[model samples]
Target: MNAPLTSDASPRLEDFPYRISDNVRFADLDPNQHVNNAVYATYFETGRVTLVKDRSHGLMPEGLSWMLVRLDMHFRSELRWPGTIEMGLGLVKFGRTSVTLDQVVFSEDKCVASAQAVTVLIEEATRKPTRLTSEIVRNFQPWRRRGVNVASPKF
Candidate 1:
């Protein structure tokens, strides 16, 4: 229920209403023993799935599904095993056919990584962008906000 995160919005943990906690499994570790860099994407995917499940209750609009277009992530710190990863998600921007989601993964309140993803709603057959309908907007009101310009990735 917080205001949308504009281009200038500096979001805090309190600003996000959706949070999912996942354990750092042994399978997710790399040779260094810390969580693998690539595994963070899957962690962010967990947050997105949980958000959609909770918000839409699995009632996604017919012939519509989200497709990932871009992802930008920053590794702030390393995560260890036998710990919980607190992943937070918020709808930072809403576009005609896409939404930008901002997420952060924390280890016991210490942020370890963060990501910004652009997910687009496309027609299942034609793969064309679909407009955001009233129903679509209504279902996502819990995390609804105006779309803003995305910052270029540092990757």
Candidate 2:
């Protein structure tokens, strides 16, 4: 696992290797007039899913799929609707059967929220955790978090 980001930490968008942008919908707000806490998870998911599920990435092998097993989120600031938010994802660690990612949601240049998500690769037929193949590991190299020295992917 990567070092936990403190609430005071200000993460730069460039530190994340994979990035995407999304609009903040009015439906995402709560009674607080800001983005609902629960909605942050969805923003983080968009970053991870877009990278892993895209056929061009080759991170997903045939008969294998990824499943979210853990997610730790931090709310740094409030986000309101009527603006675009940039979501960023960085591969932080690789386990025998799981990969960990650090993700963030930034409104303008300030990080509004961040999360660490763990997803396990599973065998489609058995629904059992599956070891990561070397090919998949290699493909993920380019997505590593800046300044992170992740451990080698264990089979």
Predicted model with the maximum TM-score: 2
> What are the runs in model 1 whose C-alpha is more than 4 Å off?
1-11, 53-59, 144-155
Residue-level lDDT of model 2, residues 1-155, one tens digit each, is: 98865433788889998999999999999998999999998888889999999989999988999999999999989999889999989988999999999898999899999888999999999999989999999999999999888988655
Q: Which stretches of candidate 2 lie over 4 Å from their true place?
A: 1-8
lDDT of each: 0.74, 0.91
**CA displacement after TM-score superposition, residue 81 of candidate 2 (Å):** 0.9
Best by lDDT: 2
Query: RMSD, model 2, all Cα superposed?
Result: 2.6
**Model 1 lDDT vs. the true structure?**
0.74
Worst 10 residues of 2 by lDDT: 3-12
